[model samples]
Target: MSSFENVTVLTKANVYFDGKVTSRTVQFADGTKKTLGILLPGEYEFGTDVKEIMEIQAGELNVLLPGSTEWITISGQGEFTVPANAKFKLEVKTVSDYICSYIAE
Candidate 1:
């Protein structure tokens, strides 16, 4: 995973699924933002307002991406994308750490 040295934090954090997932937003020097988070072992469905790239930093995730029937397994150091205004489901077999980058539409 890449480090965000000298980045600015958004000053607010996000919690989802009753705290099963939580993230803090940070902005790069170029004005790009990303959320760094962790997910406990469980199933979760997420919706995106913009295109998102989810990069796994630790543990494993089984993901059912939009427009797909098969669940793809992504381990630590892997990544996946979800389109704008779309949804995807994830099944975590172990505690998972991730970084999500949002792409402007």
Candidate 2:
């Protein structure tokens, strides 16, 4: 639903959660990197070394952020940020498309 023209693609990255999740890495001209991916219905945990902003492009997700017991719902076009060296858990209710931006710490 979005366009990222004139950007440099770094490489292809695949994350297999029993073939439930996968992603590709993209690099922009400004040294910013992002992962455009999809998540099948499942529960997953992810760790981050740098700050990251995850933008939901389609479908929905229930996320338990770092140090939180409450699960926050992120619908299509919604976003959430995770701090450096933090981790987050996600419950994917449906097939979800996402764009995860990596930020410099």
Candidate 3:
């Protein structure tokens, strides 16, 4: 979707990698939450407590998903999913914009 309506956006930012990566939580009415974030050119690893669907809006990157020997490349726009309680790696080639939706299931 191009935009989200009637959603609540948290004021506090989620920062990581010494401010190289930052995001804000967006809460929907259905009790689900998503994060809109920016990732600078760098390598980053993240652990998830829930299944996450990452929607890449812009820029380029390579993702190392859990139990994978290959790094998937995402340029401009792409999407990837990570299982709950798993760790994944990302190599951001450029300033990447993404929205990550936290799934309860």
Candidate 4:
């Protein structure tokens, strides 16, 4: 989907990595939540409390998923899933746009 509708977005941004990574919470009617964000070329590590699907809308990046030795490269658009209670690493090569959906275990 190019955009989201019928959702409520929080005004406050979720800032991380000294403002290099920022996202806003988007709440849906079904009680599901997602984050729309941008990553400005940097390395970042994140831990998840729930399963997450990261949809890369635009940009280039390498992802090291939990327990993976390989770094998956995404140049334009891609998607990856991270299990709950796991940590993943990212090396963003360019300004990246993404949507992250949090799923219950």
Candidate 5:
């Protein structure tokens, strides 16, 4: 499998993934959908056709996906995945520091 790692910085908006959404202050290690930390405030929603795995680390992050809209606060790090083609949205609440997220594919 090809390994890919990338970082995304959100200044004033949230990151939307088809139907899966997450806080911008979230980081995924390489190719996993794990969370690194919660850098800011936001909501994550997922569609039914979107499929992805995520991981989080470090600070803290609030996560939201389809079937559930409750906000999840995470600190240090964590991991999760989204289904395929889901309807997702994010609302940037407040952020003291810039949000950094990494993705590997």
Candidate 6:
């Protein structure tokens, strides 16, 4: 991972857990392959397991889950749990980072 300004640049795509971005390949329903990237702190609405991917273009933030009725905030670290085909939003708390999050859906 690389950091420029306040955003961390992702070297390889992987699964996001807690505060760690691991190296792995995520498959979507449409069969698109994506290598994960930097996860800027915030809220993300991953519509569901089928929604495939999310590209967060900001840093330090709050995220709204796709199908849920709640707003979650992340300071230094956070995790994203996506069900199949969920749609959501991200509320950036600090400067934003450009994270390319992709899924198979």
lDDT of each: 0.91, 0.89, 0.97, 0.97, 0.45, 0.51
lDDT of 5: 0.45
RMSD of each: 1.4, 1.4, 0.9, 1.0, 8.6, 10.3
TM-scores for all predictions: 0.92, 0.91, 0.98, 0.97, 0.40, 0.42
- Per-residue error for 28 in candidate 6, Å, reads 14
Q: List the residue pairs that clash in candidate 2.
A: none
Model 1 lDDT per residue over 12-54, tens place: 7799988889899988888788999989999999999999999
Tens digit of per-residue lDDT, candidate 6, span 1-105: 543233343455545545433344444445454444554445443344453444444346677776567887666555565556557676666654443355443
Alpha-carbon lDDT of model 4: 0.97
**Candidate 3, position 90, lDDT:** 99
Model 2 TM-score, all chains together:
0.91
**Number of backbone collisions per candidate:** 0, 0, 0, 0, 42, 37
> Model 5, range 7-104, lDDT digits (tens) per residue?
54445445454323335343444433423223345454434433655554444556676566685655555555555655533343444132232333
Instruction: List the lowest-lDDT window of 10 residues for candidate 3.
Output: 1-10
Q: Poorest 10 consecutive residues of model 6 by lDDT?
A: 2-11
Candidate 1 TM-score over all chains jointly: 0.92
**What does candidate 2's lDDT look like per residue over 30-72, in tens digits?**
8888889999999999999999999998988899999999999
Model 3, span 1-105: residue lDDT tens: 699889999999999999999999999999999999999999999999999999999999999999999999998999999999999999999999999999998
Which prediction has more favorable lDDT, 2 or 4?
4
